[model samples]
Target: MNPVAIRDSYDVAIIGAGPAGLAAATLCAKGGLSTVLFDEQASVGGQIFRAIEETPVTDKRVLGASYWRGMDLTRAFRSSGAQYVPEATVWSLTPEREIGVSLHGGSVLTAARRVVICTGALERPFPIPGWTLPGVMSAGAAQILLKSAGLLPAGRTVLAGCGPLLWLIAWQYLNAGAQLSAILDTTPAGNRARALPHLLPFLFSGYFRDGMKLLRAVKREAPVIADITSLRAIGDDRVTHVEYRRGNGAAQRLAVDNLFLHQGVAPNVNLPMAVGIKHRWSDEQLCWVPVLDAYGNASIDGIAIAGDGAGIAGAEAAEWRGRLAAMAAARALGRSVPDPEETHVRDELARCLRGRPFLDALYRPARIFRQPSGDTVVCRCEETTASQIIDAIALGCPGPNQMKVFLRCGMGPCQGRLCGLTVTELIAEHRGLSPQEVGYYRLRPPVKPITVGELAALPKTDAALYAVTRM
Candidate 1:
């Protein structure tokens, strides 16, 4: 994918091309703001709507009704007159609204009057023994292949972990006529009981009916093992078998060519955190999330976070959040958004989020899964094991930052994106403190790795020249 021509500045800059970013760009551009949208992917839609334009999944049933919704969003965004830059990385975003984007191996420095980060969410790390094995991957990864490339695993595959995504993936694979060996459901038996209080609202929401349909479809085609208290992938170089234990029962192993794991997703917070957005550990979601107002404005002025990056309210809510944030940005830029329009977006967003608490409760990952033990590898990038993290804590490491000093747990190239939550949870458990008290990694920019050549190749302005030479 070739890069689009970039301007020196824009009225609004969106850092993702998912539902939120797309919706925000459409609104901003339609409102007469000179808007620019940057997405690292070759296309938009983040994960949920990935490959909305390019996917080869001709049968809508394969990807489902929810996915086809992105077609309308893409159509709106393309016609809205916003500059859409595909294969672009907005790696460094400053609090003052400067954006450093890399395209075709070079960096472009641009600015915006107001910035909306819609980087969306990442699959919460599912670290287990042998997860680092070659054939093992995330369920999200598998779905990406099905969506983007119309590809599926060649042999028997096992889908493990708990979350709506797990079932969705299983159903997708089934609908696509792919082979499914089994599904290892690790949802604790008590989760349903815990989720019951929130049930009434969940049943009334739009998701309930659709979710039940997907659930029934998946269960009918796939063999499901429930209450899987433990899981492991077995192989020397690549996962050849999936071993799991149900309840307190003896372990069982199934030969499988692919092992896809998921425990839901958390906000993709690296860029926002690097930009100094205030964040807190979400107790319900079990991950770090940005602190934002109702309009998605963050702690810093001129910066707002929408979509799952604000919190995981799913894709429809993300689109609404994007509109809300765009409206806030437009207002901040001295543009007027009609009161009724703002109220409608706000109301839609509320309706979308009404069932979120229930979903969060029902799908909350178990503590044992969140905090691994012994030989389980916690940080895949650093090869930092759960035992290693535990030893650091036992040796008086107070938190993730200090543990980094002791074991280099979060300093790998991926920078704690994979291990940050795990390390925080491990430390919290050891110290008998909450994740909030334990805290997250102190992040910095450029959030994504950039080449020295890329930085030096940056169009050398007065400030750029000054920074390279003290004289």
Candidate 2:
């Protein structure tokens, strides 16, 4: 099959149809650029703005007015004239900016153009004893299961972790008819005390209303505990109990059938890293965000990153960033637009992002001192022990990538999505590089696995043509 014959190029290809990607696509399309938005899920909203086929019983109470705004964004994307392809998994992104998307019918789409990656984020998992148990799941995953599938884990489940997500998921479970055993938050109360000054602006603006709603939900459902020290799920096939230490160093155990854990989120940088975009370690966010200008132009000439994928801002910031990126891309393509409107949008987003007190406080993983137990595997693939990693550090491995070569820490089915950040931190602590300097390891394409038939069908010569053409 000739790749060119099957491929359709667009002026802009947005890889993710979430709040950010959808916003980018809508803005670009409305600006008169032929745009296409691709996503792996069978819907436009990304994880945060999840699509619900059935109106959730908890929608009115749980999501409130803010969620309706997200739905409006989705509707805008649908009507913006941009091609929205759901269930399209983008397997590889070449540095040259040719996007390889696998569609539903085994048909492949090679979209060539300026690409915007709004690939959101995954929840960071804490490696603890019995975490691999069946009933143990990320708080985000539990929320998705409840909101999207109308299902929750069996029996009473403890929602444990730090950050706003903990409260958010607890509310979801409570509304889903699942018993909330407790809300065990690991964030120190003093952290909130210190953040009060920064949070004042949001408070005055009524942005704190969201936090109040979450707190109200927590108060209504279960007891909320702060400064939890440790969590250990206990059971063979499923979680039966969770043992945790309080701030005073007293150990307590809660017997529950399920546990929801969330440390935080890391930028979903696998594909962006694979494409060789310049990344900077953000101390504030404690993650690698693609380095981009105010307009969202990344290090790559025609590639851009917006929203949480660039850094961990919520849906509002993402929407603004997406619009800014689309505007920049349009300007780069020699299109005209109102300069003052773009400037105002950028300034307002910057202010909103800066005003969020929780952004920095919640960006890093909950516990820095907590290391995976020796018996608990560090690298799931080779089953490397945490002790082994410590030993390698003592012998002076350069970084986690080197440790990966020795122990196969990152060469797993999930492709280091589960353990990469932890390994990098461990390596940085050992080698004396700042966590920022330690850096995320490089990713190579095809980022996700692909079949041989798809590879065989690639046009032999069009690689060069696709490389040169910018839709």
Candidate 3:
């Protein structure tokens, strides 16, 4: 995990140290390929298993046995012969397999015969009134704080929005003795009715027991306000109160210092899309997913995407997809790989994904939550509001790229990671088109913000060279 000793070239370069990236690296290394695994985190566990190796939470039961499962994966990744470089911020991947990365205040250019991007998932954009408030943060953020630093909300905390992660965090906070004010569930009642038919399929699938157990645990500990509406955080300098109306009830306000929001996650597509990979809108997940083959191969020949970055299929599926992608990459690189084991893994992956359609239908966020109305801030980085986006659309802005030109929705410090989905959905809704028809922002390097000093510090030997090929 040394940044200084990293080579400038490899047979395969995997971007990210999440479950998928780790699994892919392990397989490639086992095949005797010169592989390098890069990640921005100091450790290999992705968000799903963050801080598993070095968490202060001694009792693994506090976080559940599923959370502890990542330890086994990380331990295997460490023993793999692939060169693991932690704290490496990879900004771009060229079609020709050049990777631009920054680490330790310096830049490096690396090349590979095959590049696997497993950047994982980001919390789906959940824009609402007062979402930009100081105390307002994502539920995933709260979990990361808990995992990395054993930090909990100081005062009364309110969990808002929907998804299993919300329930998991609520249970974790309860276990950690944090004072949780309430749980505001935004999942519409109709979602459950629509998802009823798929329930039987899920019962026999992989996630049924665990999913039911998580729900029961949260329901036992927290007071859940279902079918919530008019959710708005109220405060001056910070979040002091959270207001919401349940079902047809009048607006109710609760004194809360922390508001943790969750509405599920979307694939982290900035890296793959930057390389001109074709993507399709997923109706089930209601987000953009890269158009990848069975083994996670992108439209481009030399690059492959795995994990939640390709699609949201959870950690176990990501590991399988990663191994499959590595096998594909190894074959492409003229290495012999086992076909039977790959077939078995693919079957297991399909089984893991059997319940996803049900989960997606059952947990789809409300329309208002997905695409907010009025003056709600849609783009946090630029402080762009939904009203501004509408104004742009009215002015003949056909897509998100033009909205970016007219309103700067995706041009900020965090790039488009924070607001891209909301912007896309907003424009699509206004234009009477699907999100894919409206199209997403055409990303460019450097994907992660980099300083000129870092660019100057790059080794002078490796120069930029990429052959342009249309896919």
Best by TM-score: 1
What's the TM-score of each model vs. the native?
0.97, 0.91, 0.96
Worst 10 residues of 2 by lDDT: 362-371
Candidate 2 residue lDDT tens string, 1-471 = 322233467788899877889889998888888888888987667887776434454556555565557778887887888887777778888767788877653546466568899998777657877777888888888877765676767777788877667777777667656778788887765666566666666665445777787778678769887778777888877888998988768788889887888877778988898889998877666667888988888898899998789888777888898998889888888775554397788776876676565545642445442356466666666667677887888887777688877778888767777777777777777777877777766678777777778876766566666776743
Q: Which lDDT tens digits does candidate 1 get at residues 3-104?
A: 467898999999899999999999998888999999999888888999989899989989988999999999999999999888898889998999999897
Q: Which stretches of candidate 1 lie over 4 Å from their true place?
A: 1-3, 338-340, 460-468
Model 1: ten consecutive residues of lowest lDDT: 334-343
Highest lDDT against the true fold, candidate: 1
Instruction: Estimate every model's Cα lDDT from 0 to 1.
Output: 0.91, 0.76, 0.88
The TM-score between candidate 3 and the true structure equals: 0.96
RMSD of each: 1.5, 3.9, 3.3
Can you give the lDDT of residue 269 in candidate 1? 86
Which regions of candidate 2 fall more than 4 Å away from where they truly are? Answer: 1-6, 53-59, 105-109, 337-340, 362-364, 369-373, 462-471
Residue ranges of candidate 3 with Cα displaced over 4 Å: 1-3, 337-340, 459-471
Lowest summed lDDT across 10 adjacent residues in model 3 is found at: 462-471
